[model samples]
Target: MTEDHLDIKTPEYVAIQFQIAGLGSRAAAFIIDQALLMIINILAIVILFFVMDGMETSPFFLTESTFPIAVVVIGLFVLNWGYFFFFEFFSGGRTLGKRMVGIRVIQENGHSITLLSSFIRNLVRLIDSLPTAYFLGIIMIFFHPKHKRLGDLVAGTIVVHERKAKKKKKLTPIEKEINLRGLTENDLELDDWTLKSFTAKDWKLVSTYASRFHQLPVEERNQLTKQIADLLLTKKGIEVAGKTDTDLENTLLVLYLVLKDEWEFEL
Candidate 1:
């Protein structure tokens, strides 16, 4: 089956739309954070003035005031930016915006976002925000296929939709058998997308159509199956063995095992 027939409920389109919405939400959060920092800075200045007013006779007031004002400015900057970078980089794979918008940053391999990755991603935010107004980042997102901003492209990160609910089901006995069958040349006869890059939706589609394989003419089915087997062998970097159907089945099983192992370890 083609990708279109997989009944994908979470295509890249949906993911990209979610990301665009998330940007707006995140921008709002940044504004709120800045406003809060400004309020704090104002309070600090007012407190500093009162303390100095109370210390009537001190020439040291000027010296002390300079240091405190400098400290307050530096502290505000750190507090304003540091809290977000620390939490987003080292804690959960989200900031307040991401959490609110139901998206998460993850590694390219689909693992949880790591501390180093987070730091690399956020540290480059300044670059992403370059040319004084984040114009570069906006242009990149507008043009790039994945809508990646500068930080995302640099850090090998992407944001995806959080699955809303758990899928509850056990593999059927036959399904379990199929999964365990291992890779064989016959499996290569399946669609390239199915054998090489089956997503969750692809697996569902395969399960739906597998029982109908006999509907095709015998010769046609054989040709398609052989094509799949050849592709599978190529993917495995294995020499093709001219063999019987059973041998082809076994080879397909081996390919399946390899792909399964890679997928599990990646996640």
Candidate 2:
């Protein structure tokens, strides 16, 4: 199946994209969370009946103490419902399950899930779980283009894969090749006047490209390098016509080196 992507244009005019988490991944996360909640519920039951009610582990133990029964009822409500709300809101859209599954909840605009939105979604989860084992929710997810359930529809939230940007730990072969190119800041031949044209935003663009460079597939890397070269290299009065893919990437790396010292701290 074709993957679904959600794009957000920030107020700063920056664009971000996220991949919608699949049903299998969502189910895994849900199962993990449910398992945890089940364990907690069991523990809570034990404490309410055995510890507080004088070691009476009877199945119908709640009748012994009205106070303990009320507490248990309230605790059940909190554990069953409030767990998702507090965790999704306070934990940056990720519960323990979602974190482990590398998925997270976010608003439609790609912002962090808000408190109200989280509450709304979890509140509607009761309906989603109705008619036996979330049957309605599973059907809704199976049919929905973005795999949204009723709760997600009401809450304006989406489950997306968490993007963890991993910087290169060591100099890979491609990076080594770029480093060996011996193109320093001086190679660009930029003076104060020429340097003044470049901005911190430009540095960010270059640095982002540099960091993600080796991680992309060859075709994407070449295409992206060419695009960046066309967009940015011309400002430095550089020509791109005769350069190989490797040469163009090296030029970008050199540009990143030149801009790093000036704009690194500003951001």
Candidate 3:
């Protein structure tokens, strides 16, 4: 199956990759959640049935009271409307269906979603569901590159596939031998705007260079390294002089890891 990836630099300055959840997967999750809600409604109905039946035989039976009807309405409202909000807010963005589907809602910036953001997104669900069966949402998701629905767009969130835990790949002998000095914060000549302009894709490119530099053939790696350094550092008005290609590459990677979280940035 084809999957879209979102690369994000985290607070720790490490670049991470997340798989974007597609419309098909989202629809499956929604259906599963709806079925569970339906079961809840059915159980509620059964409970009401027993209560009413007991009331009929009671000496203090009162058919005149509207309390039972009001209770049912409130319960239904909570089930249909509050379910998602409650689950998302409390469960770190996973509802039962989302958990089953291995997807979750998160901010596009690689940070946990705020409570108000969650509330706003869930509130927009009414609009997304308009004209029946999330028709508007489906249309939006179809066109959006990240497959964001109306609520997600409004809330600045995206649904992503949950990352599976895996063992880290062992470093090759050459990879282990690569000794690149880390760039200190003093070395950074970047302004806020330049830093902000560097997107998740840029971070991914930097990270890939750092991780695979030692494994590449020397000539090829040097050429690739020089090209990347020129684009990010020299083009941005950052001074790069007297630094070897290897040094430039390692310095940039170190700078990326060190200052990535210092600036407030978004994708």
Candidate 4:
């Protein structure tokens, strides 16, 4: 791990690294959150004003009561404070703004943000936002090696870029076959109506096909794939005019995913 990155090992013994978010991205996410909160507050105030004005109660009730205004002020304060805690805890460290910016908070150990960690971080946000507009937080992030603010340091948490599982791993053979011709599950999916027509015998035949798919001689695979594809698909009005070996294999695999739930089959 370096100053700009955080590294941790999982229980599975796999090491992972996360790019630490710096001032610019964090500021962008904060601005989005503040804008959302401002909109909510303005709408709430407007709605309350209208409700009070339209009430059947006497004008004196509206004019005399400071209680309603106090309640609104306190409620907004709680809303602001709880917003980060609620989202970070329940949404696994991502708020709406964080998700939009493709960054999220996580424990220093690369675990999901725990309830206590979320609460501690959000509690210290008061200090981070002090003296107006997060000035102190900005300074800390600029100087800190890991780009950590007071809240992050106190809570032992860090913000990082989102991880993409499929992009990080080498392509598996099944995945390669599916992607070979840009074919999606939609292209191979059978409707419930058609799926219901399949009987035990059809499953047995498909099981045999799946079991022998990898063992076939490369020269004979396409020919055998065409024959099986014709028997299963063409009879059901599926157009297999120009599908290649990969396309046919992908179609069979998609079927196996569903049928294997109820029937045992070896791949």
Candidate 5:
């Protein structure tokens, strides 16, 4: 099952690898969530019906003034949309179903889920729900390398098992193949904040990029390298002059592996 894991380095430089949740587990969680929401909505509608009946005989104007309609619409919205948003945000990425299933949503970088990211992902649920019963979503999850649905892809989030991550003591072959021995302290401009700024998720991306660099077309490779380098440079506030995009990208990834322990103070 080591093959199914995604590696994420902890603040201590320990490799903490998480198992990506598969379609079965994810579907179970989704079904649980839907059932709970359906129950809640049923109760809400029952209450609303009684309230509307009471108002129909009175002149309070609630039943006839579009207020009841508005309430029903908002209730549906909350049940269908806000439920995921609120739970994921407050629970640090787990809704009740996800928590029950022992899985959680996390930034692809392994960071805790944020409100905005949660909102974006939940918003894309509309697209994922297209053509009934999430057929498109199931197809996407089945075919996508990472098992991400449309919402996950749009929000740059992934669902992972909540189990303790498997740690690796030694570097993988890909890590060894791309070395930073030539890059000196001056080149990395090592700082505590620099190391802290990069997360396990970011490390995963770096590893993927480096490992697949040669396989990608030149244009795509260059574009990805530049994007990765720019994000790191902007976040860490460091600059490496006199290097091409490929060189800069490789240097950043290598520096991360080499100097990961140096950032403990900042963390």
Candidate 6:
């Protein structure tokens, strides 16, 4: 895709927007669920209180009077925590809220979230919801472009909207050769770089500058051409010592041929 045709929004920002929407949807769902749970708990407590009131046991005994209430409250708390944790942690990176909002969480590098990730993320909710609310986490998400909560930042995870249509480009023979012989996507898996490095926008910039080379002075055009070639060589994991302008042009030509799916070009 050409640069003009591509959306240049940073992935992190995009992720933030998706997360915000998802969070809103989730908050609404949580309120409803909690409301229902609260009513049930209230009714249970009332019933237990009345049933105990009619018993012959003394009302002054702390064990019988307070213990049952404590147990019920603790049980309810545990049940709520377990339900939220299990769903968010194990069910494809989304909770009931996330699923309703059409977004899912994944590792920063687009991998599936692990059990550890889920646990840490949910566990941190305690911190995120500190001092009464999740004010800390909300502050982080609001200020940061990636909308990452404290747990997400620590876990190196991101929440993104699920894209239904991912673009796929066919590789040319020369491109194939470089990928097959030099570095496949799996081979150059560097820690800092992401698929975004070779975004469609970068490709468009290179293509435009390359095609308009003749409009500039020969030396300048040659210099630009060399840069393009170096990019291609680096992308392919090819090493060329003391490469000349002509050599770079040759590499770029090969890249162009590959992008065009014309495998018959000479080096």
TM-scores for all candidates: the values are 0.47, 0.63, 0.60, 0.61, 0.58, 0.46
Q: Which candidate ranks first by lDDT, i.e. highest?
A: 2
- Candidate 1 structure quality by residue, lDDT tens digits, 182-250: 433355445555556555443333333344444667677566556666754555455566776656545
Per residue, candidate 2 scores C-alpha lDDT tens digits across 67-164 of 78687889898878988999999999999999999999999999899998998999889999989899888888888998899999999999999988
Ordered by TM-score, highest first, the candidates read 2, 4, 3, 5, 1, 6
- Residue 143 local lDDT, model 4: 89
Number of the top TM-score candidate? 2
State the lDDT of candidate 3 residue by residue for 171-253, as single tens digits: 54433443335345566666778877776777777767766766789899888878888877786676677887757766676
Cα RMSDs, all models: 15.2, 13.0, 13.9, 14.1, 20.4, 16.0
lDDT of each: 0.59, 0.86, 0.80, 0.81, 0.78, 0.61
**Which 10 consecutive residues of model 6 have the lowest summed lDDT?**
1-10
Compose the digit string of candidate 6's lDDT tens values, residues 35-72: 65678778887987886676536656645666776777
| Of 3 and 4, the candidate ranking higher by TM-score | 4
Badly placed stretches (over 4 Å) of model 2 are 52-64, 172-183, 187-267
Model 2 clashes, total count = 0
Clashing pairs in 5: 109-201
Between which residue pairs do clashes occur in model 6? Answer: none
Clashing pairs in 3: none
Please report, as a residue range, the 10-residue window in candidate 1 with the lowest summed lDDT. Answer: 1-10
